[model samples]
Target: MAVPKRKTSKASKRTRRTHQKASSNAVSYDSVLGVYKRSHYISPDGYYKGRKVID
Candidate 1:
């Protein structure tokens, strides 16, 4: 099967770059209910000092 070619726009490129830049700063995880959870205070030095959740 041949895939159709799509043209990339400058707006799309800028949006992609912005998203990449933002996501590069943190780590995210998913809870048991399948909802997305993200951390804002995590350091780029690879250490996770966030709080834990207790049942």
Candidate 2:
């Protein structure tokens, strides 16, 4: 079996894991509906890319 020869340091571990942190959601505001929604996703009122997709 393989094992680590030395103890891992906190600074080194934290530096490596910096990019592993959770990122904020990409939200955008809909001018027509006046609400915030995730980017590239259709609004709750059936509008996408600034056009009505459904009635």
Candidate 3:
């Protein structure tokens, strides 16, 4: 009896790499300013166009 070996593909490898890279740059909820966030809110980073001042 012969055992079959698992096969790997280039596309799968590329996808895995892309997924890893994306996961490495993921944001954490700890930085979220929930109290300041509103409907149609702009980020505190202040880089958005025509962002309304929260003050």
Q: For each of the candidates, give the backbone clash count.
A: 0, 0, 0
- Ranking of all candidate structures by their TM-score, best first: 2, 1, 3
| RMSD value for candidate 3 | 10.1
Best by lDDT: 2
Candidate 3: tens digits of C-alpha lDDT, residues 1-55: 9774877688887888885654333332323453433344456765223444554
Per-residue lDDT value at 52 in model 1: 38
Q: Who wins the TM-score comparison?
A: 2
Question: What's the C-alpha lDDT at position 16 in model 1?
Answer: 84
| TM-score of each candidate structure, all chains considered together | 0.26, 0.75, 0.25
- Between 2 and 3, whose TM-score is larger? 2
* 1-55 per-residue lDDT for model 1 (tens digits): 9774997788988988885654344447634334334564434333344433432
What TM value does model 1 have?
Answer: 0.26
lDDT of 2: 0.90
| lDDT: the better of candidates 1 and 3 | 1
Q: Each candidate: what lDDT?
A: 0.51, 0.90, 0.50
CA RMSD per model (angstroms):
11.6, 1.6, 10.1
Q: Select the stronger candidate by lDDT from 1 and 2.
A: 2
